[model samples]
Target: MVQVAGMNSMWSLILQGDAMTKCILIFLVGMSVLCWSIALYKLVLFSIKNKQLNQVVQELQSVQDFKNLFAVAKKHAKTLPGYFLSQSLRHFKELLLLKKSGKQEYAQGAGIDFLQMQMNQSIDEILHQEESHVSTLSLFAAVSPLLGLLGTVWGLVHSFLSISQKQSADIVTVAPGIAEALITTIAGLLIAIPALMLYSFVSSKVREIEFQLYILSDKMITIARKVIVEDLISVEFDENFMHDQLDRE
Candidate 1:
């Protein structure tokens, strides 16, 4: 009840503040709203992607060859890692087609290079998709404190202005205006602290996801190289195939 009355008093003070102070407060409020919205959405998205990546690799133990890997990825096409593997396999298929067509240029190592480029492009697209809206959190964290300082300075100006208008240097005349100005500083700190935390958490999660994807990509490329350079798939694709394939490299 006391907190409620204090909030009511604060609101009344805010309403009595000058136009510039009100505008600054309103902008701060908007920034907090946007920051929270993006933070919540990204947190949920990162959580899902992280969980999917955690299990996707274990599922690979059941895969036999590139074809089997592609099929498993197809089953999980909705997941981030699944999409990555499928895209990588699609590019690998093109390379294989060119290689089998007896194209001299492809046999000269151009197809492998093309596959590498395509895999890199695929990784970048997915990472960018996950990294969206994270920078906005950083922006809010960096700007909110400065806005608060600006409010603090403006509040001091308000205090002096009040004294000049009243033609008396009385504490009671200037205190209200000064306190209102200081509210902006407090508001700025509140937003900045949480924004910074969210930025750090989300960015760290993205890096972790990227690391997992890189591990997957390296394994996939190794398999592709062996298949293209040595023709391993022509041998056997039993349950022991991937275990042997990965173990050798």
Candidate 2:
């Protein structure tokens, strides 16, 4: 194949390059590998979590009361909303107990504040869990280009030194170093271009996820506050519902 010959020719050219060129190329390649690996991992992770979040949100839509919502939340305890709901419900129960102890006024004000605080902490935990390795992608995008530029500068300096030693200027003498410079520049761009794109893409995805979580938190806090302060029915955990949900899962 023509492609095979081109490949061999490129490989030979790379082999002909000096030690610095080789190292730069290798470092660029490694960054590219790591960048792509993180991209793939983030893509898969967000995809799965997004699907799960959507499913939970959809199920929550059909929930009419605190008890049913609590049942659903317990069913998907490992999910984002599920975990947050569990934390919220614990404070909800505490508020109820305090109210029964003749602390109704305190429960109305302090209870809602405490629940929101717990949910905020839960949101941070979720974001931290989902945002792993995103910074690494951005770092590689920034660092790769600089490394490539370093190689190019080194190659140019080497060529000038070579000319001084040989006391001549010609294509044959200059071509190898020029090619090495070009190769590093090309390698840097290759790594940087995709890395920048991946960084932007994953970063946007995370922002969107965070936005959704905030909206969901607001709605949950509003509903929970009403249920607590207005003495409305609250989510009551049910063992039979849990068993049924698990069976469906």
Candidate 3:
């Protein structure tokens, strides 16, 4: 009778251990699926953006009218960078209008300067938009391991509680709580690591495209300045020539 009771107790302990391990396994698998899906989605999105960015730059170079640029941006506004590009284009148009109207005081000399400032602002805004959801990835990655640690702590607490109640301790009695505690911690880390990796990779790609955009923006400003200076020079020459003609007459 004593031997049978001991065997039954041991068997019950084993069953409990198995159940805890299975629960942890299920939790880890679910977390892995969620994290991996997020990573893969981000990967595809960034990849598409990187490719489209080249096309966008090319389109900007060929664009003679700001209106066309706005239209293009509107068409692709669902994309991460597209709305930002649209905002920049709209701002550029406003600057062009200011130049044409020459309404404000100091509009002539400071026209290009104001446009440059607007350009810089627009770039900053675009970068902010691109970086919007990226921080979430980093947060999840950093938090995962801590979650795993929480599981471990919980398991330890449960183990102590079990020992106190039963007045006996063994691997069979202690391992279940430890295993359950570990499930969440492992799940957290499994969820977090890939998210961080994907965030880093995508951020690099975004920065590269941003660099190209800055270069292109600079080139555009230079061209605009040259055009304005040449126009001013031509006006000065025409006025001088007309004055001479009048004096001769």
TM-score of each: 0.84, 0.87, 0.64
lDDT (tens digit, per residue) of candidate 2 on 1-249: 999997787788789778989999998998899899999999888877777677777777766567776776777877666665666566567777777788878878987788778778878887888889999988988988899899889889988899889998899888876776778888998999999999999988887777767766776777776776887875455656445444542
Tens-place lDDT digits, model 1, residues 1-249:
999999998898889878888888899999999999998998888889888887887777665467667666667766788777766766776667666787736743887878778888877887887888889999999999999889889988978987888898778887787888889999999999999999999899899888888877877777777777766662222334333332431
Worst 10 residues of 3 by lDDT: 232-241
- What candidate 1 gets wrong by more than 4 Å, as runs, is 1-8, 62-64, 103-110, 234-249
Candidate 2 or 3, higher lDDT?
2
lDDT of each: 0.79, 0.78, 0.60
Return the lDDT, model 2, position 7.
Answer: 79
- Write one digit per residue (lDDT tens) for candidate 3, span 199-220: 7887887787688667656754
Model 1 misses residue 166 by how many Å?
A: 2.2
lDDT of 1: 0.79
Question: What's the ranking of the predictions by TM-score, best on top?
Answer: 2, 1, 3
